[model samples]
Target: MTKVLLVEDDATIRVAVVRALGQRGHAVATAPDALTGLQLAVSERPEIVLLDLGLPDLDGREALRMLRAVSAVPVIVVTAAGAESDMVRALDAGADDYIVKPFGADQLDARIRAVLRRLGSETAAGPIVVGGLVVDARARQASVDGRRLELTPREFDLLHYLAQRPDQVVSKADLLTHVWQIPYARADKTVDVHLSWLRRKLGETALEPRYLHTVRRVGVRLSAPEALGTSPEQGTAA
Candidate 1:
């Protein structure tokens, strides 16, 4: 689930949005004023924040400025203000999205999702290279040495995420959360199945692995072949 911090002073709107977003699978946290919201933003480390333009303690824009100064968390302004200037100002001040009031849950949900997707794409930390494998996230392209690999969309996503942290063991649960955007309720078998296909395309297997290696009940790791201590023939079967 995505951690969402909602900063809205109005009790009715806050309750409605919190309830609706909770039903939609987002872990929602709320504050009725700017100061409390800012405090939560810094302490809780939410994935995204839904901010309001009008607040009791501090103006929403000022709060947004303070947030931008401290963190790069995606922010979507949800307010009654519909002025183009207000929208432009917020966007200029690093707001990922702007939404006017009197909107439905579906609309708000869509906006929130769009912002999070954009944020994910923007913060890839650049292309990842592991030995001969090259995954260019910005271009959504992967290659082995000079040969470009034609990967399925899921394969590419999985590879790109793994490549970002080369040599590090990433658990299936974390993969489900980051790659599948599934915070919970998904079997680890999904990751294994995809990894099997990915391994085949990379000319590897569970017994003799090159790039993607399974570490028993722990997780998987993407690393250079030489950096691994295990022999080429040594690895898990399941």
Candidate 2:
């Protein structure tokens, strides 16, 4: 079941949303304010965050900024703020999706599912070939120079996702939901941990990476060293 962190000060709204999400087979954790939400986000590491803008202690936008500073978790701003400026500000602040107040539970659920599906489909389209490395999406496997790499299921999925979209940055939040099947509010360190393992297995390093390129404050891109103006022989999987 997907874990969700529901951050809302309103007791009624929190209870209703928690119940609705629970009925949908999700594990819901509620936080009464931005501080508590942030704490829960770090500790529980939910799959998604449903944040309300009007909080008693910290403003939602500030909380969002703080959260984004440490985590690449997918956050959906659920609030009464429907102004164009508000939406734009939230997006600029790193929100993945937004839902206005008075929205139906079904609509919220659909949006959540849509976000997850989009992430999942990002690498679902085709096989990727980068020099000696070949990633097959259909089989969810990877090989370099005709030698198969032993990967955990999560590693295979993560590598396949990156390879499928070579050169394009894939956000850590997207990777969490799409690959790990966990909520975005979880620690981005999880991605880092897995990526470190992936790099080691692939015989790569961050400073002189052979396959993975981390885009600062954005995400990661999988490409050949040639793509980075180095050499095609040093291409790496995403």
Candidate 3:
């Protein structure tokens, strides 16, 4: 059974969700607030997290930031806030998916399954090559021209995301939400900062492009010199 951490303060909602998920053959663990949820997340390492935006001890966003700092566990924000901005923010904050309140158990189950599927696909064995860089996703290790690139957890996540979809334009908004686990509106120069660090380590720059390229007003793309022969949108990151 898939293990899940359900972080919700509302007892009624929490019980309902837990029951529903349990009926679907999932092993559900409950936490009433952010602190307990964080502790459980680190200790239990659930396959996925169902996070409510409001908690008595901590704001959901703050808790999200803390969680992302330590884990890459898939998170789905279950919130009362249904505004487009709210959804965007939750995505930017690193939530794998966002489900507004009053959602049916079926919808929740589908979302949970989708997140699990995505995570499973990511962990599947494959040799990922972008430009001259080769990543063994199963090992979570990357090398450029046979020289291994030592990357921090976050940097590795960022690089892995880019490498997974080489030559595809990924907006900073998407990166901030999906990669950094920050809400999109909260996304800022942090993406740029990390990109700068990545570029420096890669021995390339936005000005003197090599592996990474900025698509004016669009986003960034990773590609190699040989891959540059195709359309700009089709370049692979080295």
Q: Total clashing residue pairs per candidate?
A: 0, 7, 11
Q: lDDT per model, in order?
A: 0.80, 0.78, 0.80
User: Residue-wise lDDT of candidate 3 within 106-223, one digit each (tens)?
Assistant: 9999989987886688878587887788876556578888888866545667778888888788888898767755554554676777787777777776667677777766788877
**All-Cα superposition RMSD per candidate:** 14.2, 10.7, 5.1
Relative to the true structure, candidate 1 reaches a TM of 0.54
Q: Can you give the TM-score per candidate against the true fold?
A: 0.54, 0.54, 0.72
By lDDT, the better pick of 1 and 2 is 1
Residue 203's lDDT in candidate 1: 82
**Residue-wise C-alpha lDDT for candidate 2, range 17-118, written one tens digit per residue:** 988988888889999999999999999988789999899999899999888766655788999988756865675465777889999989999888876666
User: Any runs in candidate 1 off by more than 4 Å, and if so which?
Assistant: 125-238
By TM-score, the best candidate is 3
The 10-residue segment of model 3 with minimum total lDDT is 229-238
lDDT of 1 by residue, 96-192 (tens): 6778989999999998898778657745677677899888765667888678887755577788879888988888889866665545634547788
What would the C-alpha RMSD of candidate 3 be, to one decimal place?
Answer: 5.1
Candidate 1 displacement at residue 147 in angstroms: 35
Rate residue 163 of model 2 by lDDT.
82
